[model samples]
Target: MSLGDENDGGQTRTRLPDGGTGDVYGGARRPARNSRSLITVVGVVVLLIAAIAFANRSGTGEGTSDDTAKGPGAGAPTSATGVRPVTGKDGTIPTGYAHDEQGAQSAAANYAVALGSDGMFKRDTRHTIVRAVHDPAVVDSLLASLDQAYSGTFLKNVGLNEDGSSPEGLTFVSRTVPVGTKVTGFEGDTATIEVWCTGLVGLAGEGSNKPVTETWFTITQKLKWTQSDWKIQSSSQQEGPTPVNGDNRASTADEIAGAVAGYGGFTYAR
Candidate 1:
């Protein structure tokens, strides 16, 4: 089973595998590190340290001049506005943005998280998510496309049951954490925003071929203000500005499952 390649309104959708292909996890286990790999990692760490030092040196000053700190391009200080996140919910997803640029960024970030979540693998929750964040004009079409994308075969490829549930004694994890967001365009009820995100995706359990792993990606959303809030009109994703892996030890499957169960996700605000 494959979700064959297709295009929808200029968005290029690729085929998702139906079998346990190594492409998703690269492999079941980490490859052995050679001397060259170690050396390269050391070099990257050295350069990163140097860059941080340089930035720190450049940032120091007696004080920021009022003239240099006043404009949009200036390094404005961020302080708490004492405002709470939007309390409205569209079937567990947040709604009711401020109808401004900041609202657009907030909407984009939250939408990215919702779209990248494990809920997307199941049929009913997938429909709820799509309807909640997408524009009315595109909701039905998007739902249809996504239903195909997350079909039973596709779910099986990622080590899920036909209905997108984890097999007994295992945990399936798919979550997106937004690192930051930027608004590239905002004008008259339309906004284009980009969200940089890191995500966890796979199954966590003994004997599971698909071990949970981390991935970095950026999502660009074209949004429109409609029905008194910002909604996604279209979106695209691309491989990330990924960083070098650190030396942290990998956690056991049980530990990962426990962490996921104990911790809840956040509602982002800008």
Candidate 2:
């Protein structure tokens, strides 16, 4: 019930993970699933993508310029929702995102979640998700490029049994976590934000090869408040201030598989 900036309107809270990153996604629908196998595909896709910048030690903009201290500004909206398997209107896209510079940061965070979710893997859902997150004018452009990026053969190779279905008993999991957001610039409803993120991707099934892995990326979005919502005008991503992976024992195939089925996702705000 609580999670956005206070002065703004309650929205989503940034996760503030190590090295900076955050993410969210669809968790209710599953055909079969997998996790490890996702690592390979995600890594390759990230490495080859166009480079861009969002927030950083040297970014410009509206983030608390007090040297990246801690917490939202004193004038923030609310707090984090802490809800899982998230759904509905807030679940569909970000809410209570600020209308100014902070709004841009919120947009970058939400967009990172939208970009790194399971929704991107499927054709129809991907289109819907893209339309929901990006500005109307650029939706077609983003969709076209993404459509080409996620081709039919690509889906099948990554474990989807064609038609965007997971293999017999596996579930496909793709999640991005926004570590933090910093506004580099703002002018009117048009603003620039860099959302730092870390991602978890893979299929959670037996004999999976991708074994869930993690990655660091930052998404820079040029956002505009169109039709009364913060929509992405254009966005680009790149590698990060990445940190070394932890040595925690990787979750077993069954554990990871079951969790995706048991847990859920959330609607983010900031």
Candidate 3:
């Protein structure tokens, strides 16, 4: 039942990178602390909280649902298909998504790149990604929801300027370079792809501000082949239970900054 680890399990939940209520309830508010005295209060508070949760059905317990915010699902997959983009298309992304399990996995991999990249942080690019990677039947509705999700607050939190745009002289980009992909299952039309990746997301400019920070994340995209192309119906991300680090020396801000600024982005190939 290791989710995103190259194995198999249950369905993953797709969430807006920022908004909406997640099964993890990660964004929900914590209950206010009681003003009661120490020792007895602490013990009783636990039971009380449980009782309240039973009555309220809100996030009042430390069960699987609570723990989910910290990790991938227990029933998620551990396939190797989520790694790279498919190759040989007209550089037009989504050129040839397969129709079976393998194709669905490929679709998942590409969609992960589409969803996790800096492309999602802006309006136009977001539209392109949504249209490019989503199930067409639900694309319009998802687009509307995505438009609402990339709110001013979410962009600001991600180190973008207040307008969901990068600051002048600085380019904001987030790209996920899929290190690898694995297929967990290919039953009929539904398939799972676990894409292990390292993401670059931050402000890029010389002596400007908000230096880019890198993160390793794995995204699981559940895909369905539709209308000749694979499409993402749902997906989710998790922090790395990553590998031990090498002794690679850290690059200078100037070097890192230069790479971020001067290097042109790629459309990625298989």
Model 1 misplaced regions, further than 4 Å:
1-83
Report the lDDT of model 3 for residue 265. 54
Off by over 4 Å in 3: 1-91
Pairs of residues clashing in candidate 1: none
**Of 1 and 2, the candidate ranking higher by lDDT:** 1
Q: How well does candidate 1 match the true structure in TM-score terms?
A: 0.73
lDDT of all predictions, in order shown? Answer: 0.57, 0.53, 0.48
Give the clash total for candidate 2.
52
Model 3 lDDT, full chain set: 0.48
Tens digits of lDDT, candidate 2, 224-258: 88877677666555556587555455566677888
* lDDT tens per residue, model 1, 1-270: 111112233433222212332333323344432223111111111110011000000012243323122212232223321134566788767788767655666677777677667777788987887788878987776666666666677567667899989998878877777666656677869877666667676776655566666656666677899999898777666556688777666776667778888988654433
Candidate 1 least-lDDT 10 residues: 48-57
Better of 1 and 3 by lDDT: 1
Across residues 212-254, which tens digit of lDDT does each residue of candidate 3 receive? 5445556656667676666666555555646655545545445
TM-score of each: 0.73, 0.67, 0.63
Lowest lDDT 10-residue stretch of candidate 2:
11-20
TM-score of model 2 relative to the true fold?
0.67
Q: What is the C-alpha RMSD of each candidate to the true structure, in Å?
A: 10.8, 11.8, 15.8
